[model samples]
Structures are given as structure tokens and as C-alpha cells.
Target: MKKRPVKAAMIGLGWWGRKMVAVAKGAADDLEVVSAVEPYGDTAAAFCKENDIRFFSDYSAALADLEVEAVILATPHDLHEEQIDLAVKAGKHIFCEKPLALTREGAVRAVKACESHGLVLGMGHERRFEPPVAQMLAAAADGSLGRILQIEANFSHDKFLSLDPSNWRLNASHAPAAGMTATGIHLTDLAVKLLGPARDVRVVCENLASSFPQGDTLSAHVRFKDGGTAYVSATLVTPFVSRFAVFGTKGWIDIRDKAHVESPDGWVVTKTSTGMPIEVSHVPPAEPVRDNLVAFARAVRGETEYPIKGSEMVENIALLEAIIASAQNGQVVTVA
Candidate 1:
């Protein structure tokens, strides 16, 4: 093939952002974090020094770099729309983390901006690159799973308990519907990937244990545009649990594992059809986040199309907003 290493900017040097930078460091052949932006200068400077990348307190400074052709945004939820718009205007390919935008309009606007600029926009739905998620997608595509019927997932972890008031994730406006935006959105993305866009959403969520303003638990029911339905839940203050089950007319495939990129010994999958559920261990043949980074590089190089297109991104964001609205209003919200 071709060697097309993208000079990229890593924005938002928080927990997840730092992890992404590490992935970039690991995949040094495919992509490079040539620049980084984080409001807290000390930590960002230290990190950039460690990684040997440029550091900036403001994102616009990174955009000025002619060599940085792409950017991976791990910024706060509310900041995505404006930052994406700016990046697209800067003529840079973009990869943004999950819950692309908190509002439907904002998400649509971001997608459209990328389209108008003719830029590759990749959503960091990293789990989509995961082995389990990839297997589920294969089932949906290859007829291994018959006509899709439903998807059930419960992805939760105990990380939010560590969040202090100063963190953006603690604010309801930043992470509405409790774990919905922070964690459950992965299942939602899997729903879209396996069953297509969601048509309706009903959610119930709460912060059960914390004295802080955090959303701890959430359960959402989604109706897909293509007749399949899904139930996905997430909790904040609990042992890590990541299970995604996709049911078809013939059989159901289930993957059980800990949260992303964590080495929990390994992952397991169970497929049930005739009688006993067949279990198998899965050690990802390739590192998922690294693969995603390489894929983004390919997209930037015009070697292939971006798998998650702008339209699907817009639809997923619509569903995300619907889920949040449903939880807050205590009713089913039809996805627009």
C-alpha cells in the first residue's frame, strides 16, 4: 500500500484525549500528534514535552499550522459544534469523540460544515473498531445473524465517581442523561451500526449514589428505523460491565468485556442459537484504536471512504438528543 502518515493535532488533553494521544504515539507510523491544545497549559506543556509535540492553550493556534492536515477532537460535549465548524473552515480532516454534539441542530450543522468543505469527518466511536463490535457488525452484514430483531447492551464503569466539581463531565448540561452521553452512546452507536438509524427513544436515568451533580444510571429503549429495536443501559458508580447483545431471527450474539482499551485478561463472546450458548475468548487480533487511527489516515489520503458518513452521524446525534430529552422529560421522544 501507500505510506500516508497524517500530521494531526490532538485537542483536549483530558483523560480520554491523553489515551488517544498514547494511541497515536503507539501508531507512530500511521499518524502523528504534531500539535495539541489544552486550556491548562502546565499539564499540556508537560504532555507535549513528553510526546515531543507542540502545545497550545487555544485550538486556533493549532489550526494555523499548514502541516497539521487533520485533528482529533476530544473536547467537551458543548464545545464540539463550534470547534468542528472552525476546523472544517480551516480545511482540516477531523475525528471527534462520541456524543458528537449535545444537540441535534448542532450535530447536523457540524456534519454539513464538513460536507461543504469536502473534508473527511470521522466520529471517534472507537468501540466500532473493537473486536466484539466488529464481529457484531459482521453478523449484521453477512447474514450470520438473520433479519435483525433487537440489540441489548449494558456498558457501565466506575470512573465518574472520581469526577470532582471542577470537571466538565460533572455538569448535567455537559453530560445529560447521566451515563447516556459518557458511556451509553457506544451502545447507541452499535445500535446504529447494526440496525440502522434510531426512530424513537425512551430513557430513564438518575444519579443514585453520588452527592454530586452526576448522572449515575441510565436505561434507554430505542426503536430503529428498520424495524429492529434496542435496549441499552449505563451506570456510573459500578464495576465495569460491557455487554452488547444483538438478536436476529435465527440467533443472538453476545460480547462481554470490560470498558475500552483496558486489559481485563481478555474478552469473551457467546453465541446462542440451537441449544447451549457457545463461548469463545477474544484477544483482538489487532489493536482497535490503532486500527482506527490508521483508517483515519487512509480516509485523509483518499485511499478509502470514511465508514461512518456524515448522514449517519447526524442521525445518531438526533437519537442522542432524543434519549437525553426522554430522560429529562420522562417520556418517549421521537427522533427527528
Candidate 2:
């Protein structure tokens, strides 16, 4: 018997939207994008015509289609809440980009809407699907790393000041906080995923570059529920660097760059107190976009569980709120 492919629609055909379209096309056997909604008529019309798919200037038209089982949102950070709510009401599964929503309340409402409607909501924390990260987490769970003691995560780039100020990312009205919320939030979310919900968070923001109206850099200190602490540093004013290291009571793991670790095959595992090295072969996963898209397709088909949960997004947003509050108040804020 022949099986039907999952019909999908994509809202927003901007930079990220194009990349998502490519991924969905690559997974065409399992999923197909039948409709795309973009406000830019020329771009949306051209893309839809080239791909032989339906195109609309408004998302409501796409959402009204009965064949569209899922909708991928690649719009700006501020629009996620309303779009998710509309999709949920229309009974469509949702795949949303990172951070989920601008505020904690918005994220909570999105989660609640999806839950009430019995729809699967997937967030774009794609790094969790990376093979090296997956292995490190598994080893930690198996007691290879013993009790985790500390974590250090860093993600920084020089693009903030270099990019045009007209970009929505530079506008705090659209994104709220600065570099940490835009970039470091991923590291913060990843840390929480590896560890647990952060118990407390303290943050500081500084205007290291004059390009932004507000601060262009942010640093945060976090304490997790298990007594483990983490430091996240991010900036748009500095050179590029991305890394994450975890120290446990028995040993540690380090992930450098995006794919490479520090030990053999770019992964390093060591005994905590003794400083003795442990042997492990680590291979990076395929590109995260492909991995996450495929995972979402499988989840839609009930073949696997969604890698990122809606409740976890609620926590991530809550922690982000606390970080911003701590930065603004110059005091540590406890996660509620």
C-alpha cells in the first residue's frame, strides 16, 4: 500500500524561511510543503511558482487549507505567540523557531493553547539533536561523568555591530534584551537541558559597542536545581567563539566549535579529581537543520517523541525573564 506524505505549510519566506524550505524539500518523502505565506509578494510568488506550491500573502489563507497538517513559523521573535495560537486553534501542528515567544507569559499561553488543542508543538532548539551533545548527555546519565559540578557555555560573534541597524534583531522593541537573548539564550537553554531548570540567575549587560542603542553584550551566572552552576558569556562586539564544557564530580566533557569536541574525534572525557583521561569516540551529527526537520516529521507521524517539549520552553522563557530582571536590578533572581 502507498502512504501519503505529510502536508505542510511555511509562514514567512525570509532568510531562515528559505533554509527551512530546503530542509523540508530534502525530507519530501516524509513531508511536503504545499503552501507558503509571505508578505513579500514577489519573493513568495516566485518561490511558490518555482516549487509548484500554493502561495499567499497572508498566513490565515494558508492556515485555512485542510490539507496542511503542520505549519512552520520562521517569522520574527515577536510574532510567534499570535501565530502559534492561530495555528493551534486551526488544529495544525506547529514547528516554531527558537525562544518560542518574546515574553514568559506569551510562551506559557502558546504551550497551553497547544496542549488544549492536542497538537504537537516543536521548538527550534536544534542543537539538542547534535550527535556529540547527545552522546555526552547519555554518558552523563550513565554515571560516566559522575555528579555534575559546573558548566561553562560561550557563544559570541562580531556581527551585531557590523550588521545594519535596520534589522529587527537590533531593535529591542522586537527582541527585548540584547545579545544574550538573541544568541546566548541557546547556550542557556542547552545548559538547562543537560542539567535541570536553573534555580537562580544573575546577569549583566554592557554597551561594549556603540552600534546598538542599548548594550551590545551580556554575561550571565546561573545556578541549577542540582546545585550545579553555569556561566554564559555572549557579545556581538567580540570575535566569534562557541563552546560548552561540563565538569562533573568524577570527570568532564567539552564541546568546542559546533561539531568538534576537545578529546579524540574532538571529544574529551576525564576523571574529575584524578584528572585521568577516559577513552571515547565522538562523531558529530549531520547538520542540525536536517536532523531537527526529520525528527519533527517522525514525531508528526507518531514514530518518535518530539525532541524539545513545550513545557521546557515555558521554563526556558521563564529563565530568560529572570536573567533580564537580574541584569536590570543588579541582583540575582530566582526562577519561579
Candidate 3:
């Protein structure tokens, strides 16, 4: 028997939200975006009309709709906690975007709300679903990368350079530590997964050209509780550069992405060992964004558990808070 697709309402109509809706169209068997909520309704209403989905100018209206089995929040950074609470109260599952909350306390509260409601809370860390990244994660988990010592990652792009100066993404209050919330958070998530919980973080932020008050370039150094370390960097002025590498006692692995996640070309996975010959493998472009949504849908349908744990969700935001604090104080900050 074919199961019905999970009915969903996309709560934001920004660049990424529209992109997600476009991708979800290809996964009709697993999910369906039945409605959208955009306070600035003119442009978004047109988009919703073009996609043949209902539109609402108010979030409460969408929450009141009985057809919405789940709510996909691609809203602003600061609005996530309150929005998640509303969704849980409405008895809807949630698939929230990355940096779930700006503060550790907010992340904890959001996670707890969903857990108490017996609702599935899906996160938006799609990089984990990328084939090459999955391989790298497996290598780190298995004995291939013996005693993971350090992990380094760089996820930078100039995609936001063209945004208006008044855009929330460019605003310091919404997106602190330059590209940390936009891109560096993903790197930190991967690092945490590979190296366990982070103990502390130190960050350096600088504004070379961009209008962002915090900076255009951000570099973060993190030490994990288990003795591993990570160096992560995110730049708003650079061309798309997505790379992740893990170093350990036995070997090292590197994954080089050819293009951005939205429109991927491919990836190159390189492995090097002390004595063994270096090996390189090519991975074709995949729809990890779509994969993440489908996985969330399956979890909503009681098929399987979501890949992101509640604990990790809280930890990532905690690390993000630490990064921002370190950037402000010019000193190491503990990840609480």
C-alpha cells in the first residue's frame, strides 16, 4: 500500500525556503508543501500561486489549518524558539532550519517542548546526507581515521554579497559572527559529530569589504572535550568553497565540493595514509536538501527516527553562542 505524503506548510518564502519547495516538488511521493506563510505576502503570494499552494500572510492562520501535518520553518534566526513553541502547541511536527536557536537555553527549550509533545523535530543540516560527507563521517566513525585528532572545514560563499544592505541576513543582530550562522555553523556541526562535544571556542572576526558589521571573514578554533580540535572558517566575500578534512593518528580524509549545496556539480574525496597510496574518489551531485525533507517526512510517518539528535541540536547552538561570545571578547569562551 502506498502511504500518503506528509502534508506540510512552508513558513517562510525566502531564497532558501523557495529553493526547498522547488526541491520538495521532486519528492512528491514522500512530502508535499500544501501551504506557505509569508508576512510580506505580495511577492510570496505570487510564488505560492505559481506553485499552486495556498498562502497565508499570518503564521497563526497556517498553524490553525488542520491540513498542515508539519511546519517547515525557514524563518529568521531570532524567531525560531517562539515559532517552534507555536508549532508544538498546534500538534504539528517541525523541520527547523540550522542554528535552531541563537542561544543554548532557547535550543534546550525548543527541544524540550517538542519532546514533551511527542513530536518529531527535524533539523536542517543537509550536508550530512551528501554522499562524500557521509563517507567521510563513516571513515571518522570507523577505525579508518584512528583516534580523530583534528578536523578542519571551510564553508564559504559570496551568495549573500548581492543582498541589500538592509537585509536581515546582513544585519549584525540577526546573523552574528559574519558567516558563522549562515555557513560556519554547518562546519561546527560536522566537527562536533566527528570529534564529539566541544569544550571551548575562540574566534576572530574581521570586516574587509562587506557591509556586515561583525565582519566578512570569520575564523573559529574549537577544542573538544574528548581532546580533539577543530579549525573552521567562513567568508562572505569568497567564491563558493566547501571543504572538510579530518586528521587522525592513522590517516586523513578530505572532501572537496565542486559547487554550492543548492546547485552541486560534484565532489572529490581524497584519502591519505602513512604508507598506503593516496586514493581519490568522485561523488556525483545529490539532492541532500530534498533527502533531508524526505527523511523528516518518514520520521513524521513513524517510519524511522530523524538523524539529528535533540542533544546535538542543543550542542550546535551552544557552540554557536560560544563562537559569537569569543568573537566579541577576543578570548576563548567555554561551550556551556
RMSD of each: 1.9, 3.4, 1.0
Error of 2 at 38 (Å): 1.5
**Over the stretch 1-336, how does candidate 1's per-residue lDDT look in tens digits?**
767689999999998888888878777777888989998746779988998899889889999989999989998898888888889888999998888898789988888888878898888777777776787798779887789998889988888777677788888888778788888887887788777888898888876887546467789989988798999998888888888888887778888774455443346777876465675666544467777887888888888887887777877888998988898766989998
Pairs that collide, model 3: none
What are the lDDT figures for the candidates, one per model?
A: 0.82, 0.77, 0.91
Q: Compared with the true structure, what per-residue lDDT tens digits does model 3 show for residues 144-219?
A: 8788999889999998889888788988888999899999999998988887789999999988977788689999
By lDDT, the better pick of 1 and 2 is 1
Query: How do all the candidates rank in terms of lDDT, highest first?
Result: 3, 1, 2
Q: What TM-score goes with each of the models?
A: 0.94, 0.89, 0.98
Candidate 2 regions with alpha-carbon error over 4 angstroms = 258-275, 278-285
Over 4 Å off, model 3: none
Q: Give the TM-score of candidate 2.
A: 0.89
At residue 18, candidate 3 shows an lDDT of: 97
lDDT of 2 by residue, 62-174 (tens): 88999999999988888898899889989999999877876679889998988788788887776676666776778778888788888888877776665678877787767
lDDT of 2 at 235: 77
The candidate 2 region of ten consecutive residues with least summed lDDT is 260-269
How many residue pairs clash in each candidate at the backbone level?
Answer: 0, 4, 0
